[model samples]
Structures are given as structure tokens and as C-alpha cells.
Target: MTSAFIHLKASRLGRMAAACLAALALAVPAHAEKLPRLVLAGPAAAVSVPLIHMVETGALKEVADSVEFVTWKDPDQLRVLALGGKADFLAMPSNVAANLYNRGQPLKLLNISTWGVLWMVSRDKNLKTLADFRGKEIAMPFRADMPDIVFGLLAERLGMDPKKDFALRYVASPLDAMQLLITRRVDHALLAEPAVSMALRKTKSFPISVVAPDLYRSVDLQQEWGRLFKREARLPQAGITVLGKAMSNDALQAKVMAAYEKSLAWCQKNARQCGEMVAKRIDLLSPEAVADSLAASPLRHVSAAAAREELTFFFQQMLAKNPALVGGKLPDAGFYGNAGRP
Candidate 1:
């Protein structure tokens, strides 16, 4: 009778286990179906290369059920998407993210994609330092943009006034500056990646003959920033960001970050193919130029939580430069999307 009772108890336990399993099986599909559909916005720049690779390789499939992508024509479109809540995630400039966060936008950076791609391209052979540009003209693009911000800080540190020490000839875009350089209208140009590559490709002295090669030996601003800020370990350029509304789900966020990280690795491994995609998808730059700019773009993927210290430094520096640049003050702990914080 005891053995029979034991058998009956075992049967009851098995039935309960089966019932629980059936409930879980029924819930998983419903939960998955309910997962938010993620819309990702990417700007047409080298910064979006990794996420582009993610989209191409179906890496996002590992995290999201359905992901729609919208390629932005310019930075303003990105701002519109953020303000309008049109996208759940976006890849944009790091400083822009900081500025937005400080302005009370519910934005949280995910990871940095590009370390630094800005370069000072000029024909000036004796262009040794910021002081050398005194009384000279530079083809500076995006008047108060990232490149200009860095230039201003470095010039001031060197005891020079950026506006007065160097004549900043502002242009509508980097391509315009490149055209100016080619036409011998400007001797120096501060160009971001892909633009630098494009300028090198379009120069008369490239791939066939060397005509005007002032853009030949461009100074990498990433290295320059490091040299100037000796205490900082990272350059922390631009990165991917997610809406604060999306960060509430830790599992989804982790999966997304993992997918993005994998995508970054894949991008580095298959730059040539990814460059072709970047060129064809958005017409941002030529395929050849994109391929060459991949390495120098300094693509990195550091989660916002892990990057807080360096980001704080960068934002604080910008705050020091112009209170408006970082929206008056450094962002609080809530600004980041780290597991501990969010």
C-alpha cells in the first residue's frame, strides 16, 4: 500500500509539472508577440556603419521581432525623430545625445559607434599645431559643430582665440570645404571621416596623378584630442541611443546591446561589403571612400553605463567651453541607461 501511495504521489507531481510547463509554453508566444516593435533611425554617415551591418546580417533578429529603419538625411531629421518619438532607437552624435538628455528629452545612449573621425586636412606643410593657424584661414564646416567645439577648446588651451587666432571660413558642408580645397580656395580644411576619404579620392593627385595633394597628410583629430586631454582614456565620439521608454525592459535591452556588439564585430570583419551597403543604401559617400574610411572611423561599442566616466569628462569639458553646448550642466545619474541606473 505504501509503494502504491508513493506511485500515486509521483503521478500527481508529474501532472502538476506538466500543467506548469503547458502554461509557460502558452505564455511565451504571447509575450514575444507583445514585445514592442522597434524602429531604428540612422543618419547617413560613417557612424551608422555598424548598425547598417546589423541590419544587413539579420543580427537584430536575435533581439527584436520586427525592426524598421529610417535613414535620416541630416542631423535635424534625427532630432525630429527623437522629439516626435518616431523611433525607439537611433544612432547619433554622442554630444548631441548629451545635449538632448540635458534638455529633458527621455533619451539614453546605448553605445559609442565611432571613436573619432574628424581630421584637419590642409595643404599647409608647416601646420604643426593650433598656434600655427594664427592669422590663417581654415575651411571649417558646421560652425558650432563637434569639430568646431574641439578646435575651440584646443585653441583656447593653447592661449589662442579660435575665432581671431585662425580665420574660420564656414561652409555649408564638408563636401563644400573639399571643393574649396580642390579649387585652391582654401589651404586648410577640418573634415570628418568619409569626407576626408572622399577628398583624397577626388583630389587630382590620387589613384592616377598627384595634382593638389594638400589633403595628403591629414592630422587625425582623435589623436590630437587624446594628446590634449592626457588624463582621459577614451575619445568617446558618437554612439547609438535608445528611448528611455525602451530601457525599462532589461532583457530586451541586453539582447539589443548584444546584437549591436555582434554587429560591430561583423562590421570590422566585413568592412568592404558593409561599405558597399553604406554607399548604396544612403548615397552618403562612394563605396571606395567608405571602405577606406572604415578603419580610421575608429568604430567602438561601449555601453552607456560602462562609458559614464569618459562621457562625464567629455560633457564637462563641453560645459566648460560653452554652457549651451551641454545644456548648462553635466547630466545626472539618470542620464545613462546602465543596469544599475535604470
Candidate 2:
């Protein structure tokens, strides 16, 4: 062939190849623009269970090359993970999420999955109400945080003082409170699951007798919340938040959230399987205890914006007692990720 003819054919082939490449690019989903790695962090509570499921199931494979789950034992560790930008997604208390957001953290709460996990476990079975435990030394965890704030709000509403009405024994973590219960060191304790379940299970085992110091799922804080606040028998407690760079990626955010919601439903349905999986990650928990906790806890997934009204009420209540609870004031509309959605 002549030189011009050969050059013309080469140019035509190049154009066709470029068109094919463009077509392939358009065919890929938006979430296909994957990140190198993604880190998810949370406490070993029910809120983090779904995240563990997502990682195990490779639910976010399309959004990231690798997905990891890290456990933060306390509020300080959680804050460390978030403040250091170590995690892209985190499971945290709703109020903490609000506090961080109000304090100008570049994070947005995606959904509230843990509604009511706080319960008052006591040795006295006859203890029917929060008022019934007057003057008792009750082991409490996360002193100024969750279960504490909820307890305070309820006590103050009932015209009782949290600090003066009851003897509150502050501890470092829920497990410490559970230990106090298991050892028969305290007659009462406010604990979140699966620590509650673990406590009940441990107390009934070998060395410990079933009758002497058997624990009861005494007054449920959620129940009191409903009766006193005239609201549902649940609280907008804990949920997942997307942070830093991930907040701007809408497609990835949607994928992460959809996976989380689906995983949460899966966990509730397959409690045994979920429990086993979660227990493997958190050595402090047992499969049976996790399963029991799931059954007892009012676990549900409500989008952050959908839960705003209830959250606003909760935040307002907290702000009343302690202005610093929610970082001085209510977080603006932007705090809720993907706001205005149904």
C-alpha cells in the first residue's frame, strides 16, 4: 500500500480504539473509582457488628481495594481514631457524632443503627423502677457519656438527682462494670450489651452460683425513656459516621451505607452467625452473649436525617443538663449525611 493509505488506516484504527475505550469507561459504575484502602472503626458494640459483617463479606470491594475494621475500646480511643483521621467510617454514639460535628469535625452521620442498648442490670429482681434503686451503689460506665446521659436526663425529669439520689460508681469501661457485677462486688450496674449478656452468662457459670447473685435485666432505661419522655421505648443512641475525604464521595457513601443497612438486617436475621462473627473479632465477647444482646437490644436502622427530629430532642435534653454534651448547641442541617432523603 502507499504511505498515505497506510497512515490513513492507522489513524482510523486509533479512532475506533479510543471510542471503544470511552464506551468501556461509561459502562463502569460510579463506585468503580475505588480507593486504595478504607478503614472502618467502632467500639465492640452492636453498632460495629454490621461493619464487621460488611468487611467479612467483601461488601465494599467495589468501593475500595481493601476494607478493615478496627475496634476502639473507649470514647478516648474513638476520638483518637477520628481526630487523627485514621478511619474513613466509624460507629459512634449519636451525641458524640453531634458533638464532633458541632465542634467542626469534617464528618457526617450516615445512619443510626443502635436505638436502645443501655439497660440497668441489678441483683435485686424486685427493683422495678429507676426510683427503686435509691441509695444503691451502682456500677456505671462511660460516666458522662451514654447510659450516663440517658440516666441523668431520666433521673432529672423524674425530679431525682443522678449524683445525689443514687451512688454511682464510675468505671473505665462497660467490661469493668460487668466485672463488678460478676464478682458480686456491686448489687447494681448500668451496662450496654453484649457486656450485659456476658455478665448474666458469666455469673451463672461454674464457680459462681446461680442463686446467690443471679443478675436480672432490671429497669430498662429505654422503657423509662418512653414512660417519662412520652416518646417511643427507644433512644437514638449509636450509629455510623463517614469522615474526612470519604464525606465528599457520594457514590461511595451510598454504597457504604447501603451495605451497612443490608448487613444490619442480615445480622438481625442471622443472629447466631452474626454473633459468632462478631465474637471472633472482639475477644471479650462470646457468641451466645452477642446473640442474646441482639435479641434484647432494640436494634434498628434509621437514616440520620430521618432520625433528626428524635435526635434533636435528645440533643436538646443533653444540652439542658450539660451545654458541653453536644458541643454547646445543636448541630446544623449539614451534620446529617445525605439529608432530605426519604
Candidate 3:
């Protein structure tokens, strides 16, 4: 009877050990499953390089399970990717987001990545201001881009129609715009940082002047927008966005917002380091250019209040300009998310 009792006790112990191992195996997978997967669309300009760094340097990995940085050659390509449900998050102009959202596409703005970084570079010594742009051919990227929109607004404020007052030459890229300016094919070109800096560096014969670096500030577009609408109109530039259909869980939405806040904080703290990391990733820019771009670029943290206010303003502008852009149905309070809510 004692021997029988001993054998039973041994069997019980073995069973307990097996149970513990099984529990551990189950727990491991549960932990892994909780991690989030994100696909980010990068901007065409070099400023987007830091976002690539945030992923490569493991800054974003701390918050997300994995991040895939996809480079878009142009705005239209980025829009196509967003529409196909291939991309989870995209950094694009607010207007583009409005266009998508209006078309029944479920996209919400999460944060603003950039503001106004456009520069009107001119080879002429006499072209000192926007007033000098009259009757001059300006090389622009395209008719629908952020630069085009901003320049159009600037022209309107100056009492000139962009299509009629100035000869707008369409260029494929900033480099192409620079080439046009250098060869004297265009009187002026809309250029952004690094490219603007690069163009000036390459052309030693013709000195290029920044007709406007703080163009938004100079023209009072924000104020004008507010005055016209009696509501705040912040320039909707670049930001993080996600598809409404894919975001089903409230818990997941909370996690994404938390991640954005954390990422923005990380970027602000390590600006210089992030710049270096981006330079290495793109392999096109020099370390010095990267550092300067990072310093000059308006990379800032967007508060929840600011994000809400800015998005609302952008949506209102779109509604006024073209309600069809938002499907003729205005965005409800839910559109702003918790960040924008009072």
C-alpha cells in the first residue's frame, strides 16, 4: 500500500510540471500577438528621412511591434497606396487627406509632421519679394501639390491669378526645378530645404535668393483664413493617418495615439541623432545637410488640442471650397477622435 501511494504522488508531480510548461507556452504567444504592426508612407522630400531613422534606430520599436517605411515617388502614388488598403499610416498633406476622406475613404489625421517649408528661389538679383513675381515664369512641381496650393493662395492675396498673372512651368521634382532655374528657363522655382541649399551650392555663377522662407507667416494666410471663416484655420500640412475600417478596436486606437505622442517626444529629444540616422538611411544627403535640415525643419510635437483644431479647420476649408471632397457629408464629432475632443 505504501509503494502504491508513492507511485501516485510521483505521477501527480509529473502532471503539475507538464501543466506549468503548457501555461508558459500559451503566455508567450499571447504577448507576441499584442504587438502592433504599422506600415508608414514616407514623404517625397528629404525631411521624411528622420521618420525612417525613428524606425531603423529602434526608437519606434519601443512602442510598436514593427514599422515598415515605404518611400512614395510622388503624392499620387502615396494616395494610391492609401486607397488600396496596403498602407496603415501615411504622412501626407491635409488637403489630400480631405480629398480621400470626402470620397468615403476612412482616413483620420493623427499628427502634423511639417508646416510651411517651401522657398521661392530666384536667380534674379532684383526679385526680392512676391511683388516681383508679376509676369515671371515660375517652375512649380505640379498643379495639385501643397506648393501649388500655397502659391496659388499667395497669388490670390497679392491680387493676381496664378494661372493668368504668372506663367507656371511644371517640373517633375525639386532637382528639375533647380535645373530650370539654373539654365534660366524659369525665372523662379519653388524649392524646399536641402534641394534649395543644394541648388544654391551648385550654381556659383548665379546667386539665388530666398524670396520667401517664412512665406506663410509673411502672407498672413492663417489670419486671412480665420477672418474669412470666423474660425481658426491652421495650415494642414503633413501628419499620421490611419484607415477608419481597419481601426475597429477602441483599445487599438488608444495604443496608436499613445505611440504617436511617444514618437513625437522621442523625435524632439534626439533631433541631431535622428538627423544623422536619416542621412545614413537615404544615402543621398551629406551628414552636414541632414543636420542642417533637421535643425531648420519645423519638426515639432503636436498637442491633442492643436491636432483637433487644425484638422477641424482644414475640414471646414475643404467643405467651403468643395463639399464633394468629403462626400457631401460633413465630418461628425467622431472624426476628430479623442485628441480633438474638448
Query: In TM-score terms, which candidate is top?
Result: 2
lDDT of 1 at 341: 21
Residue pairs of candidate 2 with colliding backbone atoms: none
Evaluate candidate 1 by giving its C-alpha RMSD to the native, one decimal: 4.5
Q: Residue-wise lDDT of candidate 2 within 1-342, one digit each (tens)?
A: 699999999999999999999988887654468788999999978889899999988998888889999999889999999899999999999999999989988999998889988889988899999999888999989979987899899988899999999999999888889888888888899999889999998888878755336889888899999999999999999999999898888877888888888888898889999999998999989899988998988887788989999999999999888989999999999999872233
- The candidates, ranked best first by lDDT, are 2, 1, 3
**Each model's backbone clash number:** 3, 0, 3
Lowest summed lDDT across 10 adjacent residues in model 3 is found at 211-220
* TM-score of each model, in listed order: 0.83, 0.94, 0.73
Among these predictions, the greatest lDDT belongs to 2
1 or 2, greater by lDDT: 2
Which is the better candidate, 2 or 3, if ranked by lDDT?
2
Stretches of candidate 3 exceeding 4 Å from the true structure: 1-30, 34-37, 62-66, 125-128, 182-184, 201-234, 244-246, 249-273, 303-305, 322-330, 338-342
